[model samples]
Target: MATPDALAFRFFSLQVVRTESLGPSLVRVTFAGDDLAHFHSDGRDQSLSLFLPAEGRSKPAVPFEEGENWYQAWRELPDDVRAVMRSYTLRALRRDPDEIDIDFVLHGVEPGAAVAAGPASRWAADAKPGAEVVLIGPAVADNRAIRFRPAEGTDLVLMWGDETALPALLASLESLPAGLPVRAWVEVPHAGDVQDVVTAADAEVTWLVRDESSAEGAFPALDAIRAAGLPSARKPYVWLAGEAGRMKELRRHFVGERGVDRRQVTFVGYWRRGLTEEQLREQPQE
Candidate 1:
């Protein structure tokens, strides 16, 4: 098959206009720029890189470059080098001359959470109006082209994720076929961590608490899902995302044991356990 245009993965720059708390653990930052008019809306999960200044410092601005070396400079950056580049999802897009809003989930004081949280959180916490930040790639669309064509009609769609995957999950939910039924299975560490999600689709949402399960291999939430079983043998589409190892296990259970058609599933490794933000992109996906 012919490949999609290279522009599909392109990015642009924007300045933060404001920030607000989504919950105790999430930050919503709104940005706008003339370049956003060119933002691509390919209906796939998109990612971006935000550069943040080191702690105990004023915001720093990097001049945007229209060349490849800019990205190289970012990648080759060494630690102990104050500046940082963090990766995050583009949760929503607006195209009235290029303005977009992105949400960054905060890490609190946890070190592991910091790897999943990025410059977006850093900026959201401390950035001020007029602060400039460059938005990186929408990062090449998923290899699998998704079509919402009503082939094997179904009564519902099942969606699940942890805090790490919430942004993408939220975006995906908004794009589902209008009136299609959906069931959301979300697992968050704390009760206050949950935030209201805005989606037009018909959905039955459920939240899971981590303490209810064992230390490992003991997910009562997942078990609940397994017990509930697939929506139907007609095969409802399933979406799974979160930490790399956890997502892999869920994928195996869903595909290996349940025998769901591979084409009807969208499983993603949003991050890996113990990997720093910079190390996350290097972890390969299956």
Candidate 2:
């Protein structure tokens, strides 16, 4: 996989170096490669596109066309022959041996699972040290994909995310300056999904664990935020990412009800309720 196409972004040939079970529904995969020597990112909420090998393929088939033409060329390949593409956020980046960590939400891999696991979930669940994957990532430390940007003189920070967005949420939280007033809410399917949040900021984190019987997990952050009183702030920045529809509702609560400036609120739709990643990719971005 060689896509030296775009200037800021390029393809990095990588393989799994280790895997760690973060919880019942989450797995953290660490990848390393010689190409990673050029990988650079500021890391907070940094997005990357991963290409995984199809069902019986040994390696992913990616087009190397320059500029945006690579997308069309990739789509032109046969469905079974093309790579399975998915989006993920960089959980952490390291030097010394040059590696990156990505956390995957194991959708339907467990026994008696309600939903069927997708290609990425299945691949992640069974990933071994030598499993290969390609990453379309930033070559510049300050690329446009890093979205958690707080304006100057921000007095307080507000954040919310679901299991799918946990990696990005945690990365963003860790990047905030020490002593900044922060409040965060995260929703996950199982109680085991909750992890200790370590940040230098004066932060309060609330975890919402949905019943195990619930398949997709209920999003209660909107109602929770609506009912609770937020800390007083001259200027507050809000960051919210999770399901598309739920994020819209939270964005409304923050801007329409809480009276936070629309410009100061940043929201990302990590996934939709029922749509597959491929299906969601076809829909225009919200």
Candidate 3:
């Protein structure tokens, strides 16, 4: 398979072939399609955009042939028929039978609410074999969405993420150079959410399972990181992704308190508290 850098964004129609619950709240959905034969992923945190159909629709209605301009064309579609677009990491990919696996964090409904699952979460929780969706992903392996790059001479990797980023973090861990030093702090809602994470790097992983009653504003991972001394490395790359507010605060802590170079740390707000993905995307960047 070609690297993402050598490929362009292409559309593919995929059908759900299987679904497995990895943990208390993680659902792994496997998709299969002929177009996947041309799909290439550089692995480590490879991201893709998925367009899911609204209720009653078998598949999202979007122009697949528009190539890079599909966004504008998709926006031009009637609102009711347009698909809900969401970004996700490619948990695993295989070409022999043209299949890709994506793990979705099934955050349960809010307290006292009848239904509170987001579009993607709801879809994953209820998805069955044969359900179809449209994906705007790489036709070749080298697309630019892979974000786990580390600078030259960097021997230590620091990672922090919530449940939503666990798949990507695990993928990055698996791809790390052998014997490299890595310290990761992962936050999840429940202890059962923790799973076995395999990696070749000399890794010290700390799982922060928050109390069920804890509010969204709680920063368990940040507290844990503050207590654990930073890894010993001259050049360290810090990667963080999770709730927007917490991520921003962590970014400030790393840069201002820890004196890490601003450019050496990569922080991504995978989601935000009290906001939908669309709303979060509309906000101005800090």
Candidate 4:
């Protein structure tokens, strides 16, 4: 059940091209790879599952070894044995035949925490001129199936998300229809989390802060949105993501109560308040 080297079109060894702090909590590590020329450009905003080895391992334990298959290994792996792999989004990808760049967000606490934690974080921390790490997934172009196309005569685009969805939000805005008015609502843990965002459309941004509590708990920003009402009478195309429950509330307020076209709204529950990524994966779709 191991992914074969012949099937390795999905695999790559990307070097850390550079690193930058986009905001207080977000770290962007640009990756360059030889195989990047083959990456599909449509994969932007799609989640990528990365398998990282321990600090000193020469070669990663690929899913299935000669003696055991990947699925059997997965079934028998100890709790600690499997925590090394993490899934993250393909925030952005720029492909040149000789190289490519992929951005990753950091999460955790330590000195220079954003730069020193998580697999990608640690990789970027120790990464040097020629350091390399494996990458596997469709390129931005191939991953664009999840992408939403603007409807004809659309006047506005509305987007909402928390930190988990920033990569997607940023990528989406970058590709939004030019000349359309756009409004985006984003929630983050603190005011320091705000980052300069660039977009192709006419833009208005509202940053929702959650210092004493999680962004999903009685969020004042969402309440404010409810009170202000949607700005366009024609109604904007809405896209929302973040905590599952909070997104549900917003969806109800928009499509249920506000009478927005159901097809015009897209909502994604990127995470749950108290669940681990694994737990969130097990959740039944509502």
Question: Which number leads on TM-score?
Answer: 2
lDDT for model 1 comes to 0.66
Worst 10 residues of 1 by lDDT: 142-151
TM-scores for every predicted model = 0.79, 0.95, 0.92, 0.78
Q: Is candidate 2 or candidate 3 better by TM-score?
A: 2
What local distance difference test score does each model get? 0.66, 0.90, 0.84, 0.66
Candidate 1, residue 53: the lDDT equals 61
Error of 3 at 57 (Å): 1.4
Clashes of 2: 0
CA deviation > 4 Å runs, candidate 1: 1-4, 42-44, 54-66, 77-83, 95-98, 110-120, 138-155, 212-217
For residues 73-95, what per-residue lDDT tens digits would candidate 4 score against the true structure? 75466644442455666677664
- Per-residue CA lDDT of model 3 for 110-177, tens digit only, reads 35544478878878888999999988777656556877888999988888999989999999899887
lDDT preference between candidates 2 and 3, better one = 2
Residues 1-286, model 2: lDDT tens digits:
4444467898899999999999999999999999999999999999999999999897888886554677888888999989989999999999999999999999999888878899999999999898889889999999889999999999999999999999999999899889999999998988999998989999999898866565564556766777777789999999999889988888988898889999999999988988988889889965
Tens digits of per-residue lDDT, candidate 1, 24-50, equal 667688888777766655543565666
RMSD of each: 4.4, 2.5, 3.0, 4.6
Backbone clash pairs for candidate 1 read 36-98, 37-98
